[model samples]
Target: MMNTWITASAVAVIAGVTGFFAVLRGSTFAAHAIPNGAFAGAAGASLLGINVIWGLAVFAVAGALGIGALGRRARHDVVTALALVLMLGLGALFVSVSTEYADETYSLLFGEVFGVSGAEVLPIAGLGIASIAVIGAVFRRLMLASAMPEVADARGVSTRSLEVYFLVVMALATSMTVPVVGALLMFSLMIGPAAAARSFTGRPGLAMALSVAIALVTVWAGIALSYRTNWPLGFYVGVMGAGFFLLGRCWAAVRQRRAVASPLPVLPNESGYLPGLIALPCRRPCCAGRSAVPAVLLCRPLCPARASAQPAAPAAPDNFPQKTAAGLLMARRGESSVCDDETSDVWPQLWPGSRRTRCDGFRLHRRR
Candidate 1:
C-alpha cells in the first residue's frame, strides 16, 4: 500500500504539471494518444524478453518526435490520430505472435498500482522531480509559445524548437505515468485536474500549483475508496476529475455574473470637458463643490471668492449633471458649470449685468 501511494503520487505530479501545458497548447489528443498507444511498445518488449520500461519509453518518444516532424503546427491532431492507429495495430501484431498471454504486459494497459513493488517507488519519485526541474527551466518560454505562438515566433523565440522540447518531455512523463494509471485512462487523471485549475485561476504559477494539489487529492481518494469498495481505481479517478472540472466551471460562471451586475463607470464625453475655463483655487471654506467630490467635501465650492463673503455651499447632489470624477468635469451640453451668484468671478460669465453673454456655451441672457 505504501509503495502504491508513493508511485501513484509521483506519477500524478508529473501528469498534472505536463497536463497544464497540454491544455494551453491544445495538444490534448496527443496527451491521450501517446500513453495508450505506447502499450504496443510494452507488448513488443515482452516478446523480445527485455524490460518493458525501455520499450514504453522508446515508442512514446518516437511518437512525439514523429508527430513534431510530420505534422504542421496547427494540424498536429491529424498526424496524432494516424500514429495512434499505427501503434495499436502494431500492439496487436506483437501480442498475436506470442504463444501465451503476457500477464505483465496486459496489466500495463490498466494500472496495477496496488501491486507495485517497493523497489520501483524511489526511482519513480526521482524521475518525477527531475522532469519537474527541466519543465521549470523552460516554463516561461514555453508559456509564451503556447499562449501566443505568432507573437513568440515574431519575437524570434524559436517556437518550433520549444514545441519539440516540450513534446519530448511530455512523452517521457507519459511513459512514467502509464504503468501506474493504465495507458487508456491516464489522460483523465492528468487533464481533468489541470482543466479545473485553469478555470479557477488565470495566473500560470497559481494554476499549476492548484493542478498538482487537485491531482494528488484525486489520486489519494481513488486509492482509498478503491481499497474499500474493491471497484476499479480508474473509475474513481475519472469521476473525481470530471467533478472538479464542473466545480471550476460553476465558480467561473458565478464570477462572470458578479462582473455583469456592477459595470465600471463610463468614460467622459465631450460635454464633460470644462472648456476654456481656468480654475481658481478655492480659498472659500465651502462644504463642497457642485460635484460633491470627497476631497473638497469639508472645504468649499470650486471657486475661492464664495467663502469670504458667505457660508460654504452644500455638497453637490447626485442629481447634479456635473460630476468631478473619472478625470473629467461633467455638465449638460452647452451649459456653464459655475454658480449663479452675482458676486462670483465665474458667475459674471453666467449672468452678466443686464447684457447677454455666452460663458463656455452657457447662454446667460437673451440678446439685446
Candidate 2:
C-alpha cells in the first residue's frame, strides 16, 4: 500500500505538470494517444520476453517523433488519431498472439497499483524528476510557442524544434505513468486536473499549482476510497478527476456571469469616437473675425428651454442657403436655420449678439 501510494503520487505529479503544457499546446488528444501507444509497446515487450519499461519508452518516443513528423502535413488531431488507431491495432495483434499470462495483460490495460514494489519506486521517481527538469528547462520557450507561434518564430525561437522537444518530454512522462494508471485512464490524469485548473484560473503559475494539488488529492483520495470500498483505483480516480473538471466549469461560468453583470470601467480614451461631433480644421471664412468661435461646430443635444427663450432671427436668402443638422436648407424669413432641434439652442450660445439679416447673412450687432 505504501509503495502504491508513492508510485501513484509520483506519477500524478509528472502527469499534472506535463498535462498543463498539453492543454496549453492543444495537444490533449496526443497525450491520450501516446499512453495507448506505450501500452502497445508493453504488449510487444511481453511477446518478445523483454523489460516492458524499455519497450514502453521506445514506442512512446517513436510515436512522439512520428506524430511530430505527421503534424507537419496534417492537422494535429488528425495525426494523433491516426497514431492512436495504428497503435491500438498493433496492441490488439500483440495481445492475440500471446497465450501465456493473458490475464496479466488485463492488469496492464487497467492497472496494478497494488502490485507495485519497492524496486520500481526508484525508477519511477527518477523518471518523474527527469520529466520535470526537462519541462522546467523549456518552460519559457514552450509557453511562447504555444501562445503565439508566429510571434515566437519572428523572435528567433524555433517553434518546430520546441514542439518536437515538448512532445518528446510528454512521451517520456506518459511512458512512466502508464504502468501505474493504465493506458486507458492515463489521459484522465493527464488532462482532467490540468483542464479543471485552467478553468478556475487564468494565471498560468496559479493554474499549474492548482493542477498539481488537484491531481495529488485525486490520487490519494482515490487510493483511500478504493482500499475502503474494495473498488478499482482507476474508477475512483477517473470519477474524481471528471467531477473536479465539472466543478471547475461551474466556477468559471459563475465568474463569467458576474463579469458580464458588472463590466469594467471604460476610460475616456477607450470610448468610441462620436461620428456626429468631428473636429474639423478651423479655416472657414465665417470664423475669420472670431477666434473664440470654431470654424465648424458639429452640434449635439442642447437644452430645449434655451432654444425657446432666444429671439427669432431672420433666415438667409435663396442664394445662400444654410445647412442644418437634419440636412434641411432654410431660405425663409424669421425661421430657425438650425437643422436639428437638439442643436438649435447651442447655436445661439455660440454666436451671442449675432443676428441673421437679409444683406450680410449673420452680422454681429453692437449693443447701443
Candidate 3:
C-alpha cells in the first residue's frame, strides 16, 4: 500500500506538470490517444513474457513520432484517432492470442495500484524525476513555442525541435502514468487538475503550482476513499478531479461577474465624465466636418457651431482644413466663395465659371 501511494503520488506530479503544457499546446486529444496507443506495447509484452515498461516506452515514443510526422498534412484529431484505432486493434489481437494472465491484461486497462511491487518503486521515481528535470530545463522554450510558434520561430527558437522534444517527454510521462491510472483513465489525471488550475488563474507559474497541488490532493483523497469503500481508485480520482474543475469554473464565473459590476477607475484628465462611461463620436453636422477627432465628447450639447462663431471658442486644431471655419461662417451668413486653393481646384470642376481670388485664395465665380 505504501509503495502504491508513493508511485501514485509521483505519477500525479508528473502528469500534472505535463498536463499543464498539454492544455497550453492544445494537445489534449493527443495526450489521451498516446496512453491507449502505448497500451498495445503492454499487451504485446504480456504475450511475449517480458517487462511491460520497455514495451510501453517503445510504443509511446513510436506513436509520438508517428503522430508528429503525420500531423503535418492532417488535423491532429484525425491523426490521433487513426493512431488510436490502429494501436487498439493491435492490442485486441495480442490479448486474444494470450490465454494466460487475462486478469493482468484487464488490470492494465483498468489499473492495479494495490499490486505494485517494491522493485517497481525505484524505476517509477527515476522516470518521474527525469521527466521533471527535462521539463524544467526547457520550460521557457516550451512556453514560448506553445503560446505562439510563429513568434518563437521569428525569435530564433527552434519550435520544430522543441515540439519533438515536448512530445517525447509527454510520451515518457504517459508511459509512467499508465500502470497507476490505467490507459483509459490517465487523461483524467493529466487534464482535469491542470484545467482547473488554469480556470482559477491567468499566471502560468501559479497555475502550474496549483495544478500540482490539486492533483496531489485528488490522488490522496481518491486513494483514501478507495481504501475505505473498496471502490476502484480510478473512479474516485475521476470524480474528484471533475468536481474540482467545476468548482474552479464557478470561481472564475463569480470573479468575472464581480469585475463587470465594479466601477472602473477614471483617468485624471477625464474627471467630468462618470466612470465606465464610453465616449462616442460627435456626429452633428458641425463636428462631422472635422474627421481628425476620431471619437470625442460623450453625449454633450451639439451646438458647438454657435460657440465656435463666438470669440471664446478656440480655433480648430492645425490638422483641420484651414477653410473649415470660413465654410461654416459662410454657410451661416448665406454667402459662398470660402474655398481654399485645394478646394478651388475642385470648385471650378463643380461650378464651371468659378474664379480663384488672390486675396484669400477663395473661388468666387459661379456657373451661370
What candidate 1 gets wrong by more than 4 Å, as runs, is 102-106, 260-368
Model 2 error, position 339 (Å): 36
Query: What value does the lDDT take at residue 212 in candidate 1?
Result: 91
Q: All candidates' TM-scores? A: 0.70, 0.70, 0.70
lDDT of candidate 3 over 233-292, digit per residue (tens): 889888888999999889766654443211212221323221111232222333321211
Lowest-sum lDDT 10-residue window in model 3: 291-300
Write out the backbone clash pairs for model 3: 354-365
lDDT of 2: 0.67
User: What TM value does model 3 have?
Assistant: 0.70
lDDT of 1 at 343: 23
Give a tens-digit lDDT track for model 1, residues 1-368: 98989988998898889988898788999888889888889888878999889889999999999888887654788899999889989988898898564665656777888988888888889988988998999987787667545435544789888988988898888776677668855788789999998777755667788999999999999999999999888889999999999998887666544432112122233433221111211112221111112122223332233333334443334422233221112222222343333323433332233343555433243212
Q: Which residue ranges in model 2 land beyond 4 Å of their true spot? A: 260-368
Alpha-carbon local distance difference test for all models: 0.68, 0.67, 0.68
Write out the backbone clash pairs for model 2: 324-339, 325-339
- What digit string (tens of lDDT, one per residue) describes model 2 on residues 136-172? 8977677656754544565478989899999989998
- Point out the worst 10-residue segment of candidate 2 by lDDT: 286-295
User: What's the CA error at residue 24 for candidate 3, in Å?
Assistant: 1.1
